[model samples]
Target: MEFRVLGPVGVWNRGAEVPLDGAKQRTVLAALLLSGGRALPDSRLCELLWGEHPPATYPAQIYNYVSRLRKYLGPDVDIRRQWSGYMIHPGDGRLDLAEFERLATLGREAQENHRYEEAADAFHAALALWRGPALMNVTEFLARAETHRLAEMRMAVLERRVETDLLLGRYAQLVPELTRLVGEYPLHEKLRCQLMTALFRTERQADALAVYHEGRRVLAEELGVEPGPTLAATFRAILTAEPARTGGPSVVASSWHAVRPAMLPPAIGDFTGRAAELSALAEVLTGDHACAAQVTGMAGIGKTALALFAAHRDRDRFPDGQLYADLGGNRGNAVEPQEVLGWFLRSLGNAEPSIPRGLDERVRLYRSHLAGRRMLVVLDDAADDAQVRPLLPGEAGCRVLVTSRVSLSDLPGAAVVEVGTLGTAEAVDLLAAVVGKRRVANEPAAARRIVRLCGWLSLGIRVAGSRLVARPHWSLAYFAERLADEQYRLDELRLGTLDVRARLDGSYLALASQSQLALRRLALLEVPHFASWATAAVLGVPRRTGDEVTENLVDARMLEVTGTDGGRRQRHRFHDLVRVFAREKADHVDRMAVAASRVLTTAN
Candidate 1:
């Protein structure tokens, strides 16, 4: 049996294509194949099929699709249930998508060993596997993501194949092909350079010169920049009747022409703690790992402060200077990557007029500028991996430090560092820094109580300290008493526009409706943490639904997963102020009823 997804998704058995009915079934198969034989959770499948608006009976619908697909696939193939989701097992079957990846890997390996002809052959074979548009029949969200990624990979392979062909001395044969490629990818400097080299080698020096001039004109008109150093060097060599230089240009001491884009926010005056996190981030700059790290945590956890502080400590490591963008993931109106790229390009010395209007072109120009330079890019408050992926430096010499409320697990090879609330000792020190060290030391007991009342949360401690600062006469005891009230905890945590309640509300508002409701019910539990089944009872949902909502809440940081109960169910905890906020939004009757039910269940 053979499975193909490069064109229309299909299953072929014994040289004949099996008839698969409905777009949904084909979509199911395509999504499974794209997973590369790994299990995809039912919730993820629903998102892939229906996007943000999955029907209430989505689980049942998915089962129906799987049942029908099983009949089509026959006895040999298995679409069985895994612990978390569905896994497709193909016995004695060939999948074209898998073959393409294998061949592409071989091509890359061969090229690295300087086997140009063999590399070109492998690349060509990989390209031949694509019959048409990938998964054309499926319009699911994940399917679109997969298709876009595949298209990009295909283009990369084409570019690599062309590079190998030029190395193999196939100059005249590449002229027409290179011409077509340059026309298709006008901003591709490498392709343009290859065309120029081909023209020069074939004794058409004038034509080669014409190509360089045309490329320069197009680049200035479209992207608002001159030809990059490599392409410019190729043109210079051709004009002097010298052999074109192979590979990219060497890093010249061209600091005068380079843009030293330093855009980081100032480090906080009294940033403290996370000694381990700081050390880990510092290692990425000097260590053998790729110069990238992702700092993720709940709002007000000091992710931005940590990133800025770490970047400043390693400032001297990046000779080209730092680039910063607040993606505003928590701010609601998050900045798009394209706009951030434009800002970065301008900061890197590209004139606004030369910056390309298209996203891909802008990304290309931005990466080209950072090619060999040692730089640091800090993308703060990113909404997701997609928002930050484009902002990453293309080469290893540059490092990217990203901060987000949600974990951007999709970033390939990113070192993920989860930031949590400051410890009691660190929180106390932060309070002293913000207020006054002598006052906190003078009233040690009261200061400890105040920080504890603030829940050891960074923003909470800062706000408490600020209030103390405003009222110089007020003792620490007085402030601690005010925050001690659970009913007014969030209220007391507010100081002008910097409200702890407001910050938490942003994280809550970002959640789905079901998760929001579940959080409200879970908050009414009146315990520090509870198991998944207990959460299910409170939310009046099935265990699966409860688990999903609980996970989302954890991701949002409204609820924290404390541990597991007997290794079967997850135990979740809510911060004191967060619980207060949830209670404010929850209905009185619903809260009381769930609370009573939990009591009864506990007693039984």
Candidate 2:
């Protein structure tokens, strides 16, 4: 028989789990197991089980649970009622808590005698006994003291084991685990110092220093104090690249240099407008606290450009490095998170030979490298939450920026910034910036008209401006007249290599069958915006389903929320360019309106 309190309170007989019944029985067993072979009175057990709310029949209930446990344990375990209370004697049974204590004692002795390898092994064995948080499924009130004591002991043993590992010169191997540990125990100076030492030994001098700065920032922000002397000394040593050696091999260095990857694609030269968004991004990314911002919009709405522009403008702040990966979400067959981590690890100075092989291990190593560094990680064109989730740094010193056409609502704690079409004035400014201010200034009305025709979208405005740049002889009015025809507006909104219709097609093809049908039907309404009821009328579905499909389109950036109407009902509008694209996808407006009127009349 073996008793375990490391996880849920339970007993195992012959390597098979023995059923312990309800919470009361488990509580009784836990009280006796934690007693270390001492007797626990019924009164103490009652208090543990029910606190001050013990019923009049509590003693009977306790006896019933005890009797049941005895029958379950069989003849090997003895549950005897003493003069004071009940005593459980696991004469031939093993107790995991006792084993943990025994191993921890052995580890302590080995460490005192300088048997680092034995000490590390013993401590690791003791720590591994914990299946999860101690007595996790047990009642909080019943397990509070034991839980705290065991958790604190576990942490102490972990620190000692890490110290032993450090003594054994396992710096490179310890980086990933130490990184995770520091995140878990951010306030522990010992762990922080150990991590700094490990980084320094691995020749990541800049990364080691960055860890120190991050620790100082975390301490000051979280606890309103500075790092203790030990951590401070480690930081100082790393700053000078002269780490103190305590009977370990000397650090071999000379060839390795900090990798500062300038991977951001060039920001658009005439990246006009988005002043408010720029300021907001600067404020969020520049803060000492780590954060993530998600930029979402339709295809060709400048989601990638906005992210790149912000990252480039704030490049100097992240002295550690800048990394960019196009997840290829728009192009389809998006890059996997593992692939991105591999590239990021290499960019962070990790050699190919040193990078972990497993996906999870790679993620850990990637985050470890970014632990203390102030870097900007921009994940562009992410497919969805899964692709972006694993790539997030989750470090205070680093800031993550993600761009996707799909809403990353699944990314917890991410500040969502929706990039919409440029305002009319901003759109005109972008045209002027691209086609030369002299031409735009000469025909300001024509420029405004041209932007309106292009639906005030940055890409649309840029494409229109590029076309005029190629034909300097043709005035803005000439292009505006060309785009004036609604039937041919999308076809005309194209310049060498820039095609609005192609971009719209990509977004359209990505939608589900129902949303596609809803969009096609709604596009034929010819209104600036319509309600879910109208969508239901066209799709021949319930209003509720219509609302769901409408929101999906919005999430896919196919529709924009204009505002609520007079009756306080949501009225969704389409981007002018999007309307044209939808019409091109489904061109039966007259028939759609006739069917819509009949559906509306029948519903009324």
Return the clash pairs for model 1, or none: 223-354, 224-354
Question: Which structure among the candidates has the greatest TM-score?
Answer: 1
lDDT of 1 by residue, 1-604 (tens): 9999888888899999899886788988888776655567786788778998989999999999999999989889989986456888888899987787678768867877888779989989998999987887776676655665566556667766777777787788989999998998887776788888777777788998998899999987876778876788887777777674456321111222545878988998899899999988988876645457889888888888999999999899887889998888887888988999989988877677777788878777777677546789999888986788677665545788999888664454467788988888898899999988999999899989988877788888999998889899999998889888888888888899879888888888889888888777777765667776775777677877777777778777788877778776667787877888888888986677687666324611
- Candidate 2 C-alpha error for residue 60, in Å: 41
lDDT of 2 by residue, 1-604 (tens): 8888888778888889998787778888877877655566665687778887889988789889889988998988899885336888888899898787678768867876889889989988998998888886666557753565466557666776777788789998989999999898786666777888888887788888888899889866764555544566677667776655555543322222446777888988888889888876887688532267888888888888888899999899888788999898876568999988989877776667656667766655565456545788899988886688778773445788999998664443457788878888898899999999999999999999998888888888888988888888998898899999989998888876799988888788888988887777677665667764666678777876676677778768888777666664567878888888887777565356537567434322
Taking all chains together, each candidate's TM-score versus the true structure is 0.74, 0.61
Candidate 2: segments with Cα more than 4 A from true spot: 1-256, 351-354, 566-568, 587-604
- Compared with the true structure, all predictions reach lDDT values of 0.79, 0.77
Question: Model 1: runs farther than 4 Å from truth?
Answer: 1-42, 49-143, 146-184, 194-205, 217-256, 288-291, 587-589, 592-604
Q: What is the lDDT of residue 196 in candidate 2?
A: 81
